[model samples]
Target chain A: MRTMRLNMQNVCLTMVLSLIALGGCDRQATVSTTSVGAASGAPDAAPARKLRIGVSIPAADHGWTAGVNWWAKHASQLYPNVDWSIVSALNPEKQVADIEDLMVKGVDGLVILATESAPLTPVARKAHERGVFIVNVDRGFLEPVADIFIEGDNKAFGRKSAEFIVEKLGGKGSVAILEGIPCTVNTDRVEAAMAVFARHPEIKVLGRQPAMWNRQKALEVTENMLQQYPKIDCLWASDDDMALGAMQAVKEAGRDKEMFIFPGAGMKDVVKMVMDKDPLIPANITYPPSMIATGMHLCVSVLSGEREKIMQYMPRHLMIDVELITPENAKQYYFPDSIY
Target chain B: MRQASTRVLSLTAGGWAPAAALILVITLGFVFHGDRAYFNWNTHRDAMRQASVYGILACGMTAVILAGGIDLSVGSVLALVSVAFSMMSLHRQDSAAMTIPAALMIGAACGGVSGALIAFGRIQPFIVTLAMMVAARGLAKALCGGVKVSRYIQDADGRYIALPVPEAFSRIDARLLGGNIAVVTVIFLACVLVCHVALTRTTWGRRVYALGGNEEASRLSGVPTRMMKVSVYALSGACAAVAGICQAAQLQQGDPEDGAGYELSAIAMVVIGGTRLSGGRGGIGLTLIGVLIVGYIEKILSINNVPEYARLMFTGAIILAAVLLQRRWHPDSEGRG
Candidate 1:
């Protein structure tokens, strides 16, 4: 009886080793087959149902875009099951191609920051047609393709900046305008400022020029304008970096006494200047780069079955409030540690 | 009298002509806008100062062009060097002496890689540098983790801290002579001088010109063509790196995306400087002129209240005009081809 039991045990051990070897082979085959299947569009039987999210954004060619990229990456890390892919292109045509590529990759949802309105509307519409959830960030699209549109109220930004200048100059001072990139945000800001400036005809606009969101360009432009308008009371810049350049020019020209510069965008540097009550930079408008986080939140909500609460039938345009960053509230906007 | 008159005209034609033209335009601009205060010494100085960084990069680019090669990676190299320098400076706050050299070395190393690929790997300068541009930018962005790394001050206890420098350098920057001139401006001028000497006075310089003028002949003449090609790119890389470090120091931060689209500007400056894009000709002096022209036009436009879009259009037009002039001057050299 003992000899028979020893033989049986040896047979059992051999069977177990063969099973382990077969299992190893099975895993290798599975990996290669899955890769091949993905390439050939074979339907996966126990498909890993990943919640794929597409992030469409402008190229990180500037500070704001850099911030957007940072926030998007941060948001992606917070969700594990969701596969996040980022595609950044500077122009509308490239952006559209990126969107189409994402669609082919079979994403469940998308987060878009359009480079322009009309050029991106069709792209958003196409994504919506394919029943993909869409969340628009910053710049808006013309068509009602987005389930949620998140952006700052640029008009308010303009009005607030203008109001500060009018109040500071006692509603009667010569001011020059430094416009941002030509877009809806720029147009809205200009229109809003115009509305306020129209009320106070005494506040003469010495010269309005576009700084193109470049510091050196702003410096040169401001210097030239300063030369042209020697008696200027204040300078209104659409962005903080440009305002910084303008202030530098004024200081360099020894005309600090004749100029007060207020730039928008509430960049950390500008907020710091406001907090310190820098004479040349007394006030600025707040438009945070973190609105990208809101778009990501909406996108996640839709993918995670909170779709009804997040999605609206009409294009849901969200206008984030802009705070006029002066000495009083500058501390609130001052993030010394923030990258922006 | 006739000979003296021709000499005066040639002198003016070479340098003073463009300078005079720029001055005349500013004067005309001032006269046209009678009540406007656009033409002044300070404005001109500020414009030139702003253009100095681009000027330095273009000076290096002119050398590369003269050697019958192109470097699209200069801008990316600049961004990387700037980021590397800023990070090092912040990390090793106690070792201030090592910061500048270390930053320069990092730039040289990056440039050396591009040189190796072009010279030894038998890669086309355009393709190699293009890849370097994309890769360097990716590396820079990755180094910062795709965020703007702001200037931070270290505490006495050797901890990182935030300190805004908007006013920190104002007093220093304001001073003349003993005052802190923007290191960038000084470095730019120094680079121009050094490049001038290297191109005109050195044996290596002769080889660079010979190679650009005729690579096959240079090879046959035993000029060590491969080494020369590598050295030229490495030099361009080093210059870019210096520019990057200057940009970071001035901005008080290392921005991963700071030098975006700057390679084109650098190339434009070189091309406009009357450097034959086909290579083997042109000098740094012409690059300075090109830089001045670009800087002045931009300054003048902004001073006149031109919109941002218009400014871009204007810059494009000026670049086109400069290129046209270059082509007209060198009909046999199809630089674009």
Candidate 2:
């Protein structure tokens, strides 16, 4: 009882302290503090002097985003003249604040992989309006609010993988898709694949389930699918980890001889299997997570005078082609140093 | 003795509602699809296996709720524990002994800190646990340096194999009793039974109800209210860690994002089991039925090849109906809530 009063008093005190703390921290905190290149805080600067590039990306919560963070850092070292402040925010609100902070700090250019496309468009547009060169990666804004847009084609990835499966089955077979949860991006992949399958009169369209993009859930879904379909000719094991999962279930049930799985996003091990010509491991589609590195490199290049003038004819919207890697060309796509 | 008997009768009465609903769903599926593949042992077992993690975490959440506390940090704890276990396994090739204890300890320590703040620091459980939730996830990200820990796995023959290959650690979520029941399900049931005993037949159990019923009254009556509050959270933390270990074994990867948003499902189980949100009421027997209800619904939907969004909508509808039914039946507790 004595503690309750003390607790109430402490609660009030803590609330007050936190308000003061939040007030003190309204300026925001960022990962990289030291600004390299010219002190752009001053108006005048030399043409050869380096400019500040701000990279705002989603935090490394999973394998892919971690790869993005890794590449962002790696891109910094490659461009010694330019200053890069790579800040990863956990959510969209933090990301918005991050962009505002970068704006306040007067970054010459901005590179962003939006936490989500729509909510981030306004801030991105603001940066573009302020004469800050904007490079959008992976997720594109609703409006053409950037100087350059770079992304792997989700639709192409779906269409090509579906085409490979149909070709392997000689245009007629039972195929089931193990979807990576129902997100806008994954749905694009599945719907495009389904559209292609719909064109083939010989192909039978079985049902699909969301594997939640986790290995264990995919394993369970695959195990259940195996039971439901006695003869599953091909599986769209779309994610690399999901492919690994579905493969495990097939191998355990000794059904590897009958079916092949196509996992995407080119994780190192999966690519290695395709390279070694593992019988069950047929091929994978390449949608590299290192697009952030590409975005970073471009941000530095376009901000510089030489590369921008030389590559003036380059389109503002660049879709990095997604490829299907078989044993023949698997070596070309494999990045042994990739985190994914 | 007489009080205990009436409580048993009340619990039995509460159990019949969800149990009957479950039976109705299973029988309806069979009745409707008599000829088609509307049923299978493997699918049912898979649902049970998947539900085991929820069951274990729900049992722990029940204890905390009964003591007038809520734990929003279980999911983060699960993620943290998973990384801790995998990181340990990396150091010691055969890490079942070391990893299991280390993971559990990390979970308990994290929860203990939250519990201590709520008890001694006089902060609200919601705020304290919420802080812990964010901090624990950040800690998990930091522990693995924000990457999946892919150390090589050692097979049964003492040969080292790469991580993509399923190894002995996968045995944690493997089936027992000739592939009928999963190891996760077994641990879940064991935890449920033990917690059922601890929350019912002990003096501490009585103290739990007293504290939740009226904190001031309980403290005035010489109840060690602070310790009970702290220990319940500790127990919840340990149970979440156990679920994490089972998850790590099942996935064969130390995913930092493992068990994300699992706390909501676990809490849903507790509430759908006829547990009052106001606390001081509910037991594990009814919770078992709640677990089965959710499991059977998901399995039936997936087996029927229902779309993912529709499956989620149905689950939400069924759980909401179950809660409404409980409130309708126990009209007297409605005011208390």
Name the DockQ score for candidate 1.
0.01
Over the stretch B203-230, how does candidate 1's per-residue lDDT look in tens digits? 8877877888889988998999988988
- For candidate 1, list the clashing residue pairs, or say none: A224-B303, A227-B37, A227-B38, A228-B36, A228-B37, A228-B38, B66-B280
lDDT of 1 by residue, A74-122 (tens): 6766765566666666655446545755665567899999865544665
lDDT of 1 at A53: 80
Residue pairs that clash (backbone atoms under 3 angstroms), model 2? none
Best by TM-score: 2
Stretches of candidate 1 exceeding 4 Å from the true structure: A1-340, B1-37, B152-161, B164-175, B178-181, B335-337
TM per candidate: 0.48, 0.51
- TM-score for chain A as predicted in candidate 2: 0.81
TM-score of chain A of 1: 0.81
lDDT on C-alpha atoms for all candidate structures: 0.71, 0.74
Question: Considering only chain A, what is the TM-score of each predicted structure?
Answer: 0.81, 0.81
lDDT (Cα, 0-100) at A141 in candidate 1: 66
